[model samples]
Target: MAKERALRRAAREAEAAKQRARRARIVARRQRRRALLTRLMPRRRRTGRLLVRRSRGQRAGIAVVTLVLLALVWFLVDDIALRLVLTLLGLLCLPALVVVALGRRTS
Candidate 1:
């Protein structure tokens, strides 16, 4: 019984070691692939000014689209209840917008 228990414990240890080695090999292979990819692909350097300008343009486009959509909705909708719901939705979005603006400022 003692020998049987010892043999079983050894087998379990061996299996665990094998699993650890397999995991190590997988991690090493992934690291090698990542390095190879980085070597093969060139990274582009973007200027801060360009990024800021592009973001501003995007913000302006979004504002214009939102205004146009809101105008259309206002003209098409006759129910005051729907308009009130829309207004409530807009108000709910305001806090989220404020949080995003604050988060961006910190970054």
Candidate 2:
């Protein structure tokens, strides 16, 4: 009975160690995937930089669209002073749009 107990304890210990090793491997794989993703994924550019990267097509499209939409909205409102208020609106929208584009999806 003593010998059997010892043998069973040793087997349990070995299985525990195997489980720990498997968990460690899984953690390592996840870390590697995160590292790879960060390297490959496009990150948001910090504000206040002289040069920033943007999708030219998207940038142009946004600008043109914003201008057209704002102009239409402005015309509908028909306030001359309001037109001056939106002088830098397009520039402001660029950074905001960039932030949204780079935002992560929340579960």
- Best candidate (score: lDDT): 2
For each candidate in turn, the TM-score is 0.46, 0.43
lDDT tens digits by residue: candidate 1, 1-107: 99999999999999999999999999999999999999999986666564353367656765675677567667888998997777677656854764465345422
lDDT (Cα, 0-100) at 94 in candidate 1: 54
Q: Report lDDT per candidate.
A: 0.73, 0.75
Model 1 alpha-carbon drift over 4 Å, by segment: 49-107
List candidate 2 segments past 4 Å from native. Answer: 48-107
Weakest lDDT window of 10 consecutive positions for candidate 2: 48-57
Q: How many clashes (backbone atoms < 3 Å, residues ≥3 apart in a chain or on different chains) does model 1 have?
A: 0
Worst 10 residues of 1 by lDDT: 98-107
lDDT of 1: 0.73
lDDT, residue 31, model 1:
100
| Top candidate by TM-score | 1
